[model samples]
Target: MRLPDKTTKMEQAVAAIPDGAAVMLGGFGVPGTPFLLIQELVRQGKRDLTVIKNDANETGMGVDHLLVAGCVSRLITTHLGLNANAIKQMNDATIAVEFCAQGILAERIRAGGAGLRGILTDIGMDTELGAGKPRVTLDGQAWMVETALRADVALLHAAAADTFGNLRYAATARNFNPLMAMAADTVIVEAEQIVAPGALAPDDIHTPGPFVDHVVHIPELTQEYAVVRR
Candidate 1:
């Protein structure tokens, strides 16, 4: 189906997501996240979601919205220092947290996109992370093998997207969006601007349309945060 336009609401954009699905979220430090759509998901009371992200919610904002709504069941992230609510929930045994190194997290998603079984890295070796997971030897050396990470759905943010779904991000705002797009079964993008097809220059396209399944414009939500300038 063709992607939705800017006039479409967040509920409409996220309607295809079923309850209890795994979702990979794009953004880091509240910069490029699709907050409006995520808020809508919480409002809809979708439950038991497994989320993969760079970090837990920021201290005062971001993914904590989901945590507060009790929509998330599990989180796989690099750090959890920011969102106090999430920490409290975890400590209370209300949420399950799985920690991974930042680089390893990115590589796992990349491996998912490339159809590889997993990625081998030393970042988690000789620690609690390496003890339980399977290890494999490559070139006579042991590596902490992380499985490829594919989510049932992926939530992404972009600076601009064409009607056909070619996407572009502004500067550092790119973050984990593009990689998550490729690694998910259903890739939904929230954009600040949605133009007619071909409006984005070929050189500026960070993600091609085939990887995107849905697109919706939600510019108002991003105005509160710093966006990458064109």
Candidate 2:
């Protein structure tokens, strides 16, 4: 018995995402984001997408590219402070933006991966984000029901990956990559470095290969990420 190799071309992987799909992107700002995959997705011109991520990314990068290309219809995220374009789009009603508290967003995705329907919380119960959302009472206190978030496809970036698709992230880049991998129906990963199956030690593997669908190797990051890659 042998483990399957999930390595694939970047173009082919992004091509599988259909228009109007719910997609999860693994990243917190520039790190851990699949820039190449996002670039390919933009080139493919898939539209009407519902994107879930931690941030809107800055102008001319990551999620902003999708916004500029008019690819995304709705963005489920934490904040749009970093990207003026994202704020403008939200204000102009060009894109519908759903804001989630950072911790709540993570828990929602974790709940999805854990196969739970949703979780009850009081984090946003008194805020606008919790407004109009369903609620329940527990121990004489009200808790808002925040549903889990699962995606049709997940785009991830890893520092290194083995042939079997085991992945490892560097530093802060690990954010959201592992969780998103589990919550998505199809998980596609872009690795800066590719190694043999056993090259990555068990302890170093952040996201196991079984949860991953496709792995693409990119030898070098684009120059725009020169400072970021540092």
List where candidate 1 sits over 4 angstroms from the true fold.
Answer: 1-9, 222-230
lDDT of 2 by residue, 11-96 (tens): 99899999999999999988898988989999999999999999988887899889999999999999879889999999999999
Residue lDDT tens for model 1, 73-191: 99999988977898998899899999888988999998998889898788768988787888778899988778999999999889899977799987777889999989999888888
In model 2, which runs have C-alpha deviations exceeding 4 angstroms?
228-230
**Over all chains combined, what TM-score does candidate 2 have?**
0.96
TM, every model: 0.91, 0.96
* lDDT, model 1: 0.83
RMSD of 2: 1.6
* lDDT (CA) per prediction: 0.83, 0.91
